[model samples]
Target: MTEAEMLMEEKLRKKKEEEEEMWAEYLEQRKKQRAKEEEELRKLKERQAKRKLQRAEQESKMNEYKRKQEEQRIREMEEKKSREAEAKRKRLEEAEKKRQAMQAAKEKREQEPVKPNFVISKREGDEMGSALGSSGLDKFANIMYARGEMGKTKEQMEEDKKAILSFRVKPLEIEGLTVEQLRDMAKKLWEKVVALESDKYDLEERQKRQDYDLKELAERQRQINRSRALKKGLDPEALQGKHPPKIQVSSKYERRLDRRSFEDKRELYDGGLEAMTDAEMEKMWEDKMNSFKEQSRGQLPKWDPENPKNKQVSHIRRLEEEDDDEELVPVFEPPKPEPPKPAAPPPKPAQQQEEEEEEEEEEEEEEEEEEEEEEEEEEEEEEEEEEEEEEEE
Candidate 1:
């Protein structure tokens, strides 16, 4: 042990011895007090007996009985006093024990922490300088404790000391102040508190929002990647704030197959689930062959190049109103023209109608003449038939 440890042990030993001597003195004092109380109690009993004897001889039996009851009450009072003294002694003993415990703890606390040791040369003639020592574990504990202390201005340091010395509890200053003034002060303080609280809340909310935005963007990038791991979280329909993806992210294999089919001008296999339609394959081929393509190499398919039943889920909105953050604008459509009415036929001339009537009369006269000719021919035939019949008979 060093000199400090030896000195500390010697001090603790002396302290313990002094406490033992004090305890012994207290016990002696308690003993003397008990002895004095006993002597007084014996005298009190002797006086009470003497009074009872006097009262019994000079008064009635009833008076003597009352005196006896008074002596009994006095004895009970003495007993109570003795019990109180005993309780007090126990309390003192407990207090002494606590004091001893506290002293022991104080001594333990006095064993100062091992500060960095400063070593000086012990030699009489040596010009060696002193060096600071390093206790490995606690080396950093004392560092930075006085880092900025040396940089403090003298005025500021003196003001700090003055404030420490002047600090004292004082009564509230309300001697001449109106209730209105107090209310106004309270209102101002409350408003200041609310403003501070609001500022703190806003700062916290901004930090939280920033963190959320960063995480969301990273999550979106991850989803857009062709990794199979992130395919499960690519739910575009579940509102993700601001703009959502309009196309589905194709997997690595899907993109590769699409590129292969585009380059080869044919599907990889015939009649399978992974096969693309002729139109879709042709579109992909066109996109691939476009040498001036502005899109990146990590391009997502606008429409599902493979069959509709593929794992790639498309979220392309058919209407502008379907966008998450955009307002729908109205589209203008021209009204259709009505069909034209049919033109009316012109009126016929009067001279053409008169000519038509004259022709009809001529046609009636020709029909009558032909009918008379037919009747004459029928009569002639009948006469010739009768003559032939007579000759035959």
Candidate 2:
């Protein structure tokens, strides 16, 4: 119970008071936090309930709209059905009327008496009118109408109707015309007819001449083709199917490689070209031709000597031979045309024919003698060449 002990007791008392205040403040803070959390949870529940109500309202509206659409579709179907039924009923009524009218006509025809009819001959003017088509177009128009051969489309029908209505002109009033005027008109018409007939005759003559010339041209062409086929030793039928060779597509090696004879022992630059057998070469050519034809849709240009054109250029093919170093492949060799021979004159009369034969015999003997001289000269040149070769050896 001294002064120092009293000072210590006062410090303890202050410490106890501070601890009590801290506890009270902590309890108040906890209560406020709990209240704030509870309020937030309540607001969240209210929002969720409001959204649910909105969704329900939207669903109700959608269902109502679907119901209205279904009702409209049903109503439209019913209306269309009613309209179709009404149209069908009208068509049946019309058909009945047509049938009744036809039956009445048949009955009236049956009740009427039959009579023999007289035949009438066509007038000369009418026959001429038909031949010259003076009234044929009018009759043709009538026939088209009766046969229903005119255009059935709406636009064409409108055009036809306009033509009928707008072109209904009155006939020429010959009652007011004078005799001299009528005669003059008739004369003019006759002149026009004569001119037309003359023109027609000239055209017919021209056509006949043209046809004859065409036949002659065709005959000449056939003869030329036949002669060409014979000279080339080819079948005329094969010529029809033959076509120009297709464009060649070479590989890089094929382009650069120098094709040489196998026995000639050729020097190479880069990889040398290898030679294939005759069979292999033929097979390859056939395959290439087939592929080209397929790509071109089996359509190829036929060679025409008369109208010659630039052909597709191809690489020169080399072939080995027993005698020669290289033999060129004649893939598309054109036939050399020979000069024409002069035609002999026709045979004369029997008395003159004897004289012509004697002359021909004399010409033959002279030609044979000249040919013998040429053969002797050729044999002498060959002997001289052999002698020179022996001396060189």
TM-score of each: 0.16, 0.26
**Who wins the TM-score comparison?**
2
- The sequence of per-residue lDDT tens digits that candidate 2 reaches over residues 1-393 is 999999999989989898888888888998999999999999999999999999999999999999999999999999998898577456445655665686578769878898664755566646645644347676786677657634478875675555443433325567878999999878977986796698699989999999999999978877787777678655554344447323223332455673544333323332334434666788999999999888997355444333212221121222224224434543567888998998998967998989988999999999999989977876786677557756766
Number of clashes found in candidate 2: 0
Considering only N, C-alpha and C atoms within 3 Å, which residue pairs clash in candidate 2?
none
Of candidate 2, the 10-residue stretch with the lowest lDDT total is 308-317
**lDDT tens digits, residues 1-393, model 1?**
999999999999999999999999999999999999999999999999999998878778788889999999999999998898577556446655665696577667768676655764564643323223334434454354346556779985785455433432224576788999898877977986796698699989999999999999989775555354245555444334456544433454454454433424433334564344766888888888784465554353344344332322343533433774445556676987887877876866889878888898888888988988877776676567557756766
Cα TM-score of candidate 2: 0.26
Using lDDT, give the best candidate's number: 2
Displacement of residue 98 (Cα, Å) in model 1 is 99
- Candidate 2 error regions (>4 Å): 1-27, 107-113, 117-393
Question: What are the runs in model 1 whose C-alpha is more than 4 Å off?
Answer: 60-393
Give the deviation of candidate 2 from the true structure as CA RMSD.
43.4
